[model samples]
Target: MTTVMCMKLACMTECTRQGIACMLTRTVPYATVPSFQKQDLNRTMDLGLAEDHFSRPVGSFVASDIEQLKLAIEECKKLILELPEHSERQKDTVVKLIHLRLKLQELKDPEEDEPNLRILLEHRFSKEKSKSVKQTCDKCSTIIWGLIQTWYTCTGCYYRCHSKCMNLITKPCVRSKVSHQSEYELSICPEIGLDRQDYRCAECRTPISLRGVPSEARQCDYTGQYYCSTCHWNDTAIVPARVIHNWEFEPRKVCRSSMRYLALMLSRPVLRLKEINPLLFNFVEELVEIRKLRQDILLMKPYFITCKEAMEARLLLQLQDRQHFVENDDMYSLQDLIDISSGRLSCSLTEIHTTFAKHIKLDCERCQAKGFVCELCKEGDILFPFDSHTSVCHDCSAVFHRDCYYDNSTTCPRCARMTERKQDDISDVKEA
Candidate 1:
């Protein structure tokens, strides 16, 4: 009777413990599995199951599916914690976790179902001011007559879309200054064929057929990527790659992204033409003249920076639109090249150069005092390093008449005197 009582007491205690364990499992949201049982869960985080959840054609996820996804995400996080950091397996698990979380968020958030959109970058949209030019929505392929339908244009990229379609644009605006400021893709229409892109639109991943059975694929000249009609819309823009590699100014058909990127890069002054294609300057007469003018601008910048009177008068503001011209001689923006071709930039620079020259040479005595005298000619007339008729010494930076420099066998008088003085000092040091 004593032995029976002891066994019954132990049995009752075990049952109570088991009931409490069940309660804990039900209460804990993220009940972690024991290390020994993790092997059993290797098949629980099925990638195919996650892909199926995302690949659903049209309907929202059911409550049960969402709950399952949350559980799977928790499982994935636990698995990730067990793996070594930055390992390939851990990385893959992390990606799966992200997908699961995105799926869960999409299911829970009703905003994802709404037509309102978001983009990869910010776009500053303003009222479409031009009434005469017929514009179209970059998002939807529809003409936007300014007088009839209200629209907005992105001041950054010149992206025009209907007022309703503004929120619908998912493509980012061109922020060339923030991205690709120094480096530009120079290959001319470096198109990876449709086979390489798997015959899909680069932006939207929409199916594109070669023969236009369902959707036609269009090529963007700038990016060399294929796009569907909705993303292309037959928009034309001068490709920077073509301009750099082939010097082709003829506008070519590009996708919406390329169009916006080029428009924003128009006046950015990021391209170093001399570094990219020095041969262009030799062929294009305007480039040659522009280079000379830029050199003169560079020389004038120091005088403007130093003179209190020049600063007070805001002399540098004359080239406010082309501030980079004063900063460096080689960098030329795409718009600068276009304006040069049309004689607009040349005329504008000529006017600015005249104004600068008047101040540096004739107007400001302080600026005139900074001018270089021709050492070879020994003339009272001041010579500037930027003067076309002058030659600057390589060693001492002394200016002289080009003809006089050649006659003097390119010998600088100042450098010669300094060399003599150095030799005399060396002789005295040796004697001492």
Candidate 2:
């Protein structure tokens, strides 16, 4: 009767211990309860404890020690609850360890419905498997190294996507190629321009151009269709679109046409190359060479001769000077003469020479002044001995003493202009 009573007490103790463990699993939401339960059951089974032995009287079972078993289970619960939560890397390590422990527990039990634990184990293993897979950039197809943080996997191939490029995704096209082998070989091709094959722009049934060649192709997480970068980026609603060139062309044809047009304009028969002013001739010759090279032709296009280009071709063949007379009053300066010669200035060279001659005189009109002046002042008083009177302002003339101008305020007395007095002018004025 004592053995039966003791056995009943031990069975109650074991049940309480298992209940506490189950309660702990429920209280800690993040804890892996299913794994811990399996582990406890396996350890109990390993100790050679039968399912019925748990119900046997404590005194009857010499192998059973209830106190020791209770102590071990309490310690395990304390350790699980006190597990440290640290950095993400440390957390991952702990999770992996937990998964390994759970897997070992699963191996011991063949008939446990531990789906949650299995899922956690699978997630942990998948990360390890992905580390071995090579990843490349989707846009450039460049290989990546180290822990890939921003990569997506599609159809067993891994591709690294930039934050902006994450939106673009498409499925790869499969193609079959025949080689020397008995059967055709299957090959993978990037799916680009697939949509254009069937669908056409509503207004113009013209096929849209794709922007870039496909490097990495996968199904779009959002749209679920294969698309090239060009079509994907374009606004589909807009039809009959115009395209702009982004590339600059070398030896541009537009420039060549412009140069030819400008050359035709400046080639005039009346404007003789040899007769042109040396400076103007050099400028036109340099311009012609530049036209031959097609440099600066863009700026010269607007100034090209339109009507004169066609007329001058025939006129230039018969090289002749078209000369005309000019009235005296019609001319101005040397610049005016050149302008007239080039048909730019409306006046004649003869008019220009006549207008200039009126202002210029061969002999001195004032005092008929020539040769030496008075010896004392170093100026000539009179041109001839017969001429006794001064014909010029005496203050500035050779007849006057240099000091005389100073005595009279050092100014030309007749013209009221400032003058430098001579030494004789000072002496003569002092004597006066």
Candidate 3:
């Protein structure tokens, strides 16, 4: 158990060590611990003794054990400060420190600490563009010198600002609830007026004037809100409203907020194309093709899941990026619709379908064993739900040759056998 725990910790350390070190250097300020204590903790960890005891369930920890863990965590933090920044040893130490802290927290309040259940919507800030690219801070309305000045850009809302100004800004990240709900603003460029916005930039509140030779006020094609050049760099994006209402794929100018919000919702399978516009499938050839492929993928999902060989091979990884294809047949993402219009998604789905088909039909005997035999002909030939010529009974979901079912004119042999057995049992029960 000790060796196994050590190995698991080593694996985790290797994976997240670099990220932890980088985060520490960028964000966390240093505080030093005693030298003797740091040395003792490092020696304990190296010997795998810490893993053996601390790796047990948090509920097993007594008060003394918890206090020891707290001290060990402080020692680990001190060790991290002593080591050089971004070094492999420093990264490894950071990982251990994080694990110790988490263990302590869980031991303190196992029942109350449920981080996963909380809904905390906040900015996911990251450096934007290249260091050479010129950009402005959305918070202070000042130029962020990319070559020297430290700045952050919210990946959620594209809210660019100085690193210091990031926490000071009161504006929350703009995330549309469109994915959680089916309703969307279906109108195209629903502009009220700059007067409605008080003639100021919608994001940064910069004053706008249209009296010049060319208007400084830039109108976002997605939200119809006007913004200054800094807040809206005329970044082109496919508008969800336009795509849903008109099946338009033309990229239009959008503000940073709309750009980031649309990006957050890119792969979410919220757009029920059939419910919104069933005629779209008929009008667009690729949409029709994609829908068929998605349906086939859904059919093949059950076969792959039950087969051991298919699981080992990860046959479903073919549709890894487009997992929503396997999830539901009717739902489509904004990106999926956009790609379908561009003639890319159908070809990709065709390739993925071919791979999935190969595994379920030809490659694995275990998967093939799950196929259904035609009850009508009593033949050895196997029929699958996804097969083009096969027909499935609506009531019992039994598969058979389409011609054989048509010949019987809606009577399924399997359903008839069950009915006969049920009647025989009923008659026997009455006699008894």
Candidate 4:
């Protein structure tokens, strides 16, 4: 009863198969003009690159080029069906784009399985009772927005995909296959609901503002889960995870990944608050105050990041022997660092911009020498060790043995600051 009309110049072939016929012979209605018309698909008839990309791998694209590649991939996928069957290199280009996209995705996230890495969203919908209702076809990622659209979403991972896409999924889903609500409780208490400005879509890291009301957007069956509709559909996995919301910083946008990472870091007893840089500490401290101010300073889009974040993610992705970028670097939202040398977060950031390990010292050199060399460490007294011939430097107000000072050098170690001040004074006098 159905037909797949192949408009070939040689054969003018027609195949009467149910699904194949629907793909080829289906007519777009007048009402659904631009969004889902069969005729409108021809807009991608000219989707060809100047240079061949079959040989190029996605890994070859550096961090700076990955953004453009992602855009190109989206465009190329749109062109696959629209390109004429006889179009030169169209099929080949799409194949190469698919290959590159997969490779790039793997390279972008090398560590496919990370312990701390959390899933932002999942397909939380149940299977449909019948196929009578129309919905977006998953294989093509196109949906017909009607008064009512029906679809099947895996309750386990929250993947609401078309039946075709679901059947074609080769792997058993990267996300968890089951929801263990009893085991993993809501770590952070969620709001009565969420607003667009208040919550970020876990998958895309964008605000969850659907039209004006945030609740128009969907949420998981679980108590604390919330994400934009875009993240909900795009997600292929369902990792039972909790969200971290900052009630204090309600208005200023912060990535949900950042919130999750912060929660992850808080769970880490190894990292001490003292070990963090003052600036980082200030950022954490300022988080509570940011809500008071009425401005959005953060770049909210996770996929589209600033140059600094792009470079950081690029360096992280190029690692030689890591399953994935460590310490939520793959999230690319927050910069959580640990001293590789000290192997701990006990060190403090001494310099504004320097190697985290080098600039960050566990303790001052004087504190390190405590008990071993400085007997007066933490005593607020001075040490004197020379056969009862103790002396004190008036300039430094410190008691020391006469031998501690260089021969005829009146200043002690503590008085070096005064000596510099004096030298600076002399220099200023001469200059003046």
Tell me the TM-score of each prediction against the true structure. Answer: 0.64, 0.14, 0.64, 0.20
lDDT of 2 by residue, 93-157 (tens): 23322222322322332232322211111111112223322544454344322122233332222
TM-score of 2: 0.14
Q: For residues 183-240, write the lDDT of model 3, one tens digit per residue.
A: 4456799997889988888877878866632338889998888988767778899898
Kindly indicate the candidate among 2 and 4 with the higher TM-score: 4
lDDT of 3 at 41: 46
Ranking by lDDT: 1, 3, 4, 2
| Candidate 1 error regions (>4 Å) | 1-137, 142-170, 176-182, 423-432
**Candidate 3 lDDT for residue 362:** 89
User: Which candidate wins on lDDT?
Assistant: 1
Clashing residue pairs, backbone N/CA/C < 3 A, model 4? 111-323, 122-158, 123-157, 123-158, 123-159, 124-158, 136-143
lDDT of 1 by residue, 231-279 (tens): 9878899888778767778999988777766776678888888778888
Q: Give candidate 1's whole-model lDDT.
A: 0.71
Q: lDDT of each model, Cα atoms only?
A: 0.71, 0.29, 0.70, 0.36
The whole-model C-alpha lDDT of candidate 4 against the native structure comes to 0.36
Clashing residue pairs in all predictions, respectively, total: 0, 18, 0, 7
